[model samples]
Target: MSAPVVSVDATPVRAIALILIGMACISVNDMLIKLLSGGYPLHQMVFIRSVIGIMAASVFVWLEGGWRILKTERPGLHLIRALLIVSANMIYFAGLSVLPLGLATALFFVAPLFITLLAIPVLGEAVGRHRITALFIGFTGVAVMMLPATDWSDIPRAALLLPVIAAACYAGMQVMTRKLGAKSAASAMAIYIQLAFIVVSCVSYFAVGHGRYAEGLDSESLIFLLRAWVWPAPEDIWKFAVLGAMSAIIGYCLSAAYRLGNAATVASYEYAALPMAIMLGWIVFAERPGWIMLLGTALIAGAGLYVFARERHRAAPGEVPGPAAERPLRRG
Candidate 1:
């Protein structure tokens, strides 16, 4: 008997599943950071995590034909992509330490909008009426999410902007990743990104962490950013390793998902992170998002879905796939 055949159409389903599971892993990683932010400096956490992540990523790179798979012609592009991912990580964590996980994750939802906008100019992808409309609706969602509420006085002003900025940086990284996906190995991309994180974390530790902030700088965000490093307890070493392993997993899954599916389809599935973040926030931190936030999330999801549908419609049978969909994953 012949083995059952898998349809090519199932690629999207596999991509979506990979992305959703990846997001969940990321949320769990975020939860660990949020839990630990009160005690350790952000750079310290990142330094340790990246060290572990590099080790993990290196093993994967080795297993994928012993580092030979990492050869790349576009070293400059890889460096830029690495910087984007590292910057996004710092900004998002800065906001996350203060903002509720759900809200911070919600704000990062604007990444799809940024990605769509970037693609038009950077990749020369065409945008039609439907995508234009989707962009407007998505921005409206961002506006709704950012509007000051009656309780707004309780939240720091900087907290509101950081995650959105992070989202933009992340979107740029995603676009660049897709552009490079055709030639770059997934392990190579991840290894480069992790190395970037390590370099940035070391620089940050020497630059910002050497000078201790005055006492009583206790706002969650400020403390996370400015606190002097503390030596990790023996048990904490294990926790940091786990965090790094999760980061490695996140990098692999995200790279694979984009490599396998169209960017629009993969990006829309990113919204799945919001709900996972919300649940984790509620259970772990007692965060309850207001009704207004829920409305904003709904708008963002609807707009993203519309964009996904439009992208699918634009792809006609037998026509060439765009840059995003054209990249086939190369095996070593």
Candidate 2:
């Protein structure tokens, strides 16, 4: 059977709002993650966040009519997608544990580049010479951005691999989304992924022992890590609730955005998250990204924008088309 197609039209104001809200929620999620990295084990953080996500999703499923909302014709694909997402989260969090928030996030943006390459095989879409050339330029930019630190010998090389691997897994997850298409509910897919995360986190936590929990940091750092496990304070409960609500809202908005515009267009705009994160880091944490990092961000953003523009031009009517077609793949 042919894959399901979502309609793409002029962007809506509400869609823009949804995208912004989604970006903010995701940014906040990352900040919380950064906060928790020092004390709580990454596995524990994954487990807690997944549990919160599942619980929140479960409520929606129940309110939407119980088991039916969880139904899917593609269980195996769901499993694959979940595995990809879980892996991506683990790798991403691991990278976050060591890397600066903005830097790690910048590297993660490479996932779209990977997704473009994967589409050729996974989606059977042809990528033409020009798009391929653009893709190469993009990767070159990514490589430049990924240049080793001046004190590279001081840092463990292994640490650098984590974000790269995470980006690949995330890209795989996005490609699978297109493959799964409308055959599955986005909420169900998200639910199962969280379930997978819970399972993995439980396994890792038991294997590693809770005693290794970040114990030696100063009080301030200790509080940050503990933030992941601690129940929301009276004042903070509303914040967590807002986070969950925002998650659902963003989920719907992304779904709607995909329906209204090509994935390339939507994905291009996603880079907006980077600037937002950078600003958040500055305003909230008094952190500023370095010039090299900014240059790297520019390269990556430029590459993505180049690909996005090319895809849009090709998709436009009466244009001399390239072999690479912009297909809207389901990406969570």
Candidate 3:
């Protein structure tokens, strides 16, 4: 029997649902990184994860018809994207090593705002008064979240800087992804990113010395690594496997969403990951953001949602839109 035909146009509710699932997958990926960090060097963990991802992507390509899908007209753009993504991952993992999950995730929220600013230069997407106001509010939220008025005299300033740098690199990656979208398949982009990460991780790992990897693995760390590697005594192997599967699914959905909608719109929904991450952290790790952090998160989420809603309204027929209409706003 022939496969059933799926609708090309997903309802807004369906798109929102897929997005939420994608966000959950992303949050769980972060949780896994945190778990593995305890037992392995961040570089090694990134390398291993990238290797797994590369293998998974390879299979996907083969089933989809080999090197044809991997072929890209924009190899240079792909390389640039790889570099940005690798750098962003390194910085983000470094930040995660020190900063709490919620805080680190909060800092990473700046990527969307950065993307909004970048759209003008890279994608030539025009920004309007409403988006400008939203951007200001969003940045204010970031400032409040990152530089809160608290006793931070002893904290390493690097903690704050790392995520900011990561966010900037991530924004660049998003812009590049938008540029490449016209010429490449989503699977191709995913393959390039995974391969780039694998190469980067391998280089970083060997340069750092393998002994450091062994040294980093204490009993607790060993247990975490072993669980990840072997799935030993894992009560949640199925859960982790599902998480991995969801990662691939989310990648596809996000690509589709961006293809169908604007990046700024999709990016606005990206902040949805924050509240989910915060709640997960609170429940799983007993972590909680302070009142100020909560307020900042609210601002960020609201601003992003505003952007998303405006984009959606503009995309809908008969809605009076502004500058955003003249240019194509692509996404990662």
Candidate 4:
């Protein structure tokens, strides 16, 4: 039998759908990471997922013309991007293990603002009054979300910092990505990230996960970090593999969405992940965000939209959007 031909029209509707699907996949990936974190060392799951991620990335690289096409003159920059990814994922994953998914994701959404701030120092990008105001409003939202009604002693205050720190690291990575711009291919960069994740995961497993124990730590985040290595259940092995596939799927969908549609429009659709995370958290974990947290999320999202709108308005006709304007929220 002959194969059938299939054509995909990259319309606005299709792009939006792709972005939403990518966000949904990312949310599912986060949920799986949270579920696995309870029993396995975070690095172990990351290591396994990276292994699969590398394979998936490899397939894409091959389709794009093999290893030679993945060449980059800027190896050092790639390593830095990888390190940032490792750090951001570690912090965000730790937060996910302990914090409510909605809250953690809401906090992480502040990365766009962080990117605006970092660009001034890292990319030498000019930041005007509007961007500065957005940054201020975004950080205010962070403060609002971080302050619990009862007390800091009631929850692990340190754990709360994880997502904030993750936002910083994630923003740094995005800035680096923007710096590299057309110098590197996105698929090749992704492969490097997966490779870096594997290296870091192995080092972490050997250094801290091999014979470690939580000891007397009562914090969920601490326990998740210091937990010793163990053989994953067979079912979990499958889950991790699925997560690996989802990682690649997310990369492709996000890339396609941005390539097909307006970057600002696609970026807005990325917020779809927040609601998806909230719904998953509620249905799977029976968790709900407080009104304060919800309000904070609104503030953060609004600030992000302001920044996005400003970027779109500033771009000259036919000019490609800057990374800050086009980059979607980093999925943890």
Top-scoring candidate (lDDT): 4
| Local accuracy by lDDT, each model | 0.74, 0.62, 0.61, 0.79
**Best model per TM-score:** 4
Candidate 4: 10-residue stretch with minimal lDDT:
1-10
lDDT, candidate 2, 87-193, per-residue tens? 77667767666666676777777776787788888878787786677677766766765677552334455666677788888777777766665344445545676
Give a tens-digit lDDT track for model 3, residues 1-332: 11122333545555556556667667777776665565456555656565556666666667656768776666787798778877887778766665667777777776666777888888787888988898899788877766644623334656666777787787777666656543455455567777777687677655653444345453432233232222223654444454345445545556544444444445456667787778877776776677767777777667766766677666665442333222122112
Candidate 3 regions off by >4 Å?
Answer: 1-14, 63-66, 123-126, 148-155, 210-250, 260-268, 314-332
TM-score of candidate 2 relative to the true fold: 0.79
Position 305, candidate 4: lDDT? 83
Residue-pair clashes per candidate? 0, 0, 1, 0
**lDDT tens string, model 4, 142-248?**
89887855422366777888998998888888877778763444457567778888899889887788545777777788788878988878777789889898877
Models 1 onward score TM values of 0.87, 0.79, 0.76, 0.89
Residue range 99-141, candidate 1, lDDT tens digits: 8888887777767667778889888888778778878988788
- Could you give me the TM-score of model 3 versus the true structure? 0.76
Please tell me which model should have the higher lDDT, number 1 or number 3: 1
Error of 1 at 124 (Å): 4.3
Q: Given candidate 2, what's the lDDT at residue 306?
A: 77
Residue pairs with colliding backbones in model 2 are none
